[model samples]
Target: MQVELNSIWQLKDLDGLNDGLYRVLQLYPQDQIVIVFPLVDSKTLQRPIKVGFEQLNEALRVGKAHLSSYELPYYQLQSEANISASHLAKRNEKYSLIADLISSPRFLLDLVEQPRIKLVSLHAKKHNTYVQNLYRVLNLYWKYGQEKNALLPSYKNSGGRGKSRVAGTKKRGSPVQLSCPSFQAPEGVNTTESDKVLFIRAMKQFGLKGEKVRYSRVYDKMLKEYYSDELIAAEAESRNALIPSYRAFIYWIKKLFPAEKLIRKQTNQGDFDRNKRGLRGAATDHTEVPGSCFELDATVLDVHIVSEFQRNHVLGRPTVYCVVDKESRMIVGLHVSMEYASWRAGRQALINSFTSKKEYCAEFGIEIEEDDWPCNHIPQRLLCDRGEFICKDAEDLAVPLIGHLSIAPPYRAELKGIVEHRFNILNEKLVHELLGTTKGRSYIRSDKDPRLDATFTLREITKLLIDEVLEHNSSIFKDLAKQSALIIESNLPPTPLNYWKVHVEAQRHALSRVDEAHARSRLLPISKVTMTSKGIRLNDQMYYDSSHSDFNDWKVIARNNGSWPLEALIDHDNSSFIYVRLEKESGFTRCNLMRESVNFSHRHQADILFFEDWIKLEKSKAKPTAKSIERYQRRNQVIKSAKEELAQAPSLDSKSERTNGMKARRREAILAQRLGEEKPELKQENSFSEFDVYKEHSDHKKQKVVSMLKRKQVERDEN
Candidate 1:
């Protein structure tokens, strides 16, 4: 092998030379001689020695001399920009002195041709370095690569960074100050191995997990447990104990246990994962376009609302459900109802998201163009919380509408943060300012009750919510990070409407169209309703009927036999109609509430169920009343008296004897009953004047004769 300059080699079994690693400093191939520098673990400079080329070649041929791998220094691997400015200035200054000599072509030749002692002496004199700075710079250059940055000072090794120093007898940092002259402080003590053991015990017992006690408490407990004797003596003498300070204890604790590990130990797994853990990625990383994913969640609003039927009767806070698109951060659907947050209310929100919004807004008395709040398509995937979506029914119903249903783990609200954050925006913007808001009254006493001030009905609150949703859709998004190509090209503001419109126009959305009737039927909650002879019965309270041809036949069959049950889809928000699946091959048929269940029409299913339960409870309460028991006993007594009267009468021996004088007895009984009743007396009247009476009689006779003549004439005309 050919020997090159600055190449390290291990010399073994070499004649008249000690076995060690050596580096070739200068090469003289024409003279058959070379200068080698010994590599050793010492900062002291070693003199280079000249050696014959043939001897080195023979050693290498026999495998006695071979190239050795050199590990790079830490400073060599670091970037030059990271080095301190002072260090860089000093490095440049050192390199400037030896620049001409190193850049010359005869520098290596001179190292081989000139005597080593004379060369060192001349460089020391030329550089005016009595302490051998010239030799140090040259040595660093040859030890590392032949680069200017190689002359940089090793300042990283000077301060003993990242290393623990052995404890001395005295203190380590500046002395502490006393608050007063009478108050004595502890004699500063350096941290020792024994003190560290006590710190570990205290941290494990009091500071690490279970209950998060304060650091001061841990320090006090440590002193009481580990240095009790010293503490007692100090207290007795009116002085402080000679123990490690709280700062030193905290230092060792942090050194032993990391902050993240301590946090995990202190909190529960769910809390730590939800609150303290670092976010692994964004929720929208997998979603490429609008409608790719949607988040569904519900929250109880802060304001109280009144019932639609009775405005004076204040219903408690209403629950609002919002579905937000993950890509655009837009609320695609919204629902506000008196019912609590459950699957019954959640499905209404989903139905709103999958159907048209024009008619829905119109029903709320908030007319809007289609583009005002235009989000009426099913998403590819739906992400929801575990409350309403972690059930078999939710999966069975929503999976077919939206391509997939993803339920987030319990307590992990961040998984559906898009919708969860929308609740805060809504409360801040609208609900908190309402008349009967309970936002700040939860923990404090107020002069007036919020319920008494409630004025907005449920329908009115819903209209306000729809208006807010429209405004939110058109408002600019403050935290929108991802943008589509079409949005960037058009340079539109980052509003949900803009993002949605541009993507839809370019056909970059993942929205899919579904039949509104099919979606509504599938999303409605299913329950068994009896097919009765009168009509279809729901929950044994509400009755329904359909105009379908088979319904009449089914009713007839039910009348002949017993009532049979069938599965029907129920819309909990409105009891006016229910969708019934008659056959496997047919779609759902709409059934209207019957006249018998007219009280339940336009009422919430929850209200109807509540009424039924309340009525049953009232009946149960009234059953054991004293009045009811007395009435029952009085009826039994009356029946007993009638039976006795019947027994007193004689019995007929044969049918002929019983029927002998039935008609005569009935007439006699009728006459006897009439005779027992009283009759009214008649009154008489008379005239006193004779002339007046005679004149009245004459005029009456004349009128009668004229009438007779007129009647005869009429008869003759008819003949």
Candidate 2:
């Protein structure tokens, strides 16, 4: 007899029990009530039975359990109040009989075995025992339980009964209606077309920007202006349906218009545009293979990062540029710097995308495998917006290296949504949780200054970005629809790494290592400069290799046209070195600035700017002076004397020193050798020929140095 919700339960045999199946609808523990419906016929069900769980348990213990089961019929829900009110208002005779049958459940149960049930009505002259009336009462009980409203007749009077009752016509009760009313409208004046127009005008006024009038205020205004005291009285006297109840008017307003559409119409263009696409409608399925479409975009990072070199120097917000593969929704590459979104930043981000991230991770002390971030290949198509993306620098580099570069229309951010979404994911995973983060809109932002709360340096934030990117790529997304049989069969989880491996790996087109190096070389800015006797002149600085090889090797070419304009690749970040390739060389050679000691060596663009400012300040303070040659010579002599003294003096530790006894013996041996050994060696074993020495020094005699002609003549003579 115990049952679970929405489960099929069979009643045990009892003396008064009917043979049927019961479905548990709802259960109340404290009341021990188990409401169920009995399926008397195959399709239709009897009244929903309200039996106590304890009583059912007792019956089940004493009687045998039935095994047959049945499916519960679908019951549509509808309010019975209107029908019941109408029936009571009409003083219908059938309403009393139906109410009595529904109220007396035991009587209804007794009549279940009876062929017909007697209906006693005050309007009826004799007792009516029609099976149809009994069936109607039983059907109401089954559908709507024992509620008094269930006995009320339907509102629709559809029977074709003539209005004039003839004398010969059989006496009958009023026809019962089963159809629901078309409009269960409130008791109020109906609104007219003119009123709707007025309401629209009111809505427009209320929805104005910065005004944002409340609905209650708008309603009051409508009452004061459109439905004035004079109009209300006139409409009431004429029984005109002009003014509507507040509730009904509000309902009509909601039914006629949607909130989102209204907001879009009244809001600013920026917010309106976003509302037009919204969150749901903007998504586009990426079925293309990875590397075919890549989105490139940049955003200012929300978190504040300080300079690693200077702690107090808060670097402000750094711009982060990312390239996202559309197919896998993976962040292929990212660049974070204090620099804004410029072509230089975009170029660096592109290079990162085409290079393995393992080395990059190692730089940040994050141990990651090459496979963990497999997005190193150049994309077939690069998608970007119309910022630095269309600049000359990007065009020059991408045209030769990448397969294609595409520029999206202005204000169409959805075109590069993958990278935009990647930026959001990065913010959520790393930036928002960090200290000194402006997490939301400017108006809603906290009063506390994020710069003051900043804890991590630029390098530390870079590490955090790397970790977040790794997790984003490898973590299971679970966003793919599970209904696809192909996905289920593949057994691959919805992760960027998995998607890349499953779909993009098989037909992946990648650049070779040599090609990658060539691409990198071509991507850098190229400048044509002349090679002089000193070296390649770049601006005010002279650049050359250590052996002055560039001057020697390219000097002949410069001599051909008096000046050689060779192509030099320059990185603005580092000023000390520039790359130059000779006519015969396959790759460029790095040339360093000649006077590095005077210029403070290689410097980045920022350092160079600072250096230029220092030079300006120095020039402003410095004054020209005249000096005597004698004084200059005297100063040079003092420097020369200092250098000579340093060279002649023995160092602190001398290899010539020995112990006192060893030194004495060494001195005695040296003295003995100086006295006798020199005399024994007086007879020279051999001596250089005086004639040959005199010939080498003689003015008349000459000797030819070794030459190719001389070597050829000597070879012929020997043969």
TM-score of each: 0.68, 0.50
Model 2, range 403-519, lDDT digits (tens) per residue?
688998877777677788888888887799999898844635558888888877766777899899989988776654232233345687778777776655455533223344465
Score residue 398 of candidate 1 by CA lDDT. 87
Query: How displaced is residue 545 in candidate 2, in Å?
Result: 6.0
After best superposition, candidate 2 residue 539: deviation in angstroms? 8.7
> Compared with the true structure, what per-residue lDDT tens digits does model 1 show for residues 223-325?
8888999988988999757888888887888887888878887777878877889988876788889999999999888888776556776778888899999
Off by over 4 Å in 2: 1-190, 204-248, 258-264, 268-273, 276-284, 362-369, 390-401, 440-446, 455-457, 480-493, 508-514, 521-523, 527-566, 570-579, 582-719
> Who wins the lDDT comparison?
1
The window of 10 residues in a row where model 1 has the poorest summed lDDT is 679-688
Error of 1 at 502 (Å): 1.5
Q: After TM-score superposition, what is the CA distance of residue 528 in candidate 1 from its true location, in Å? A: 4.5
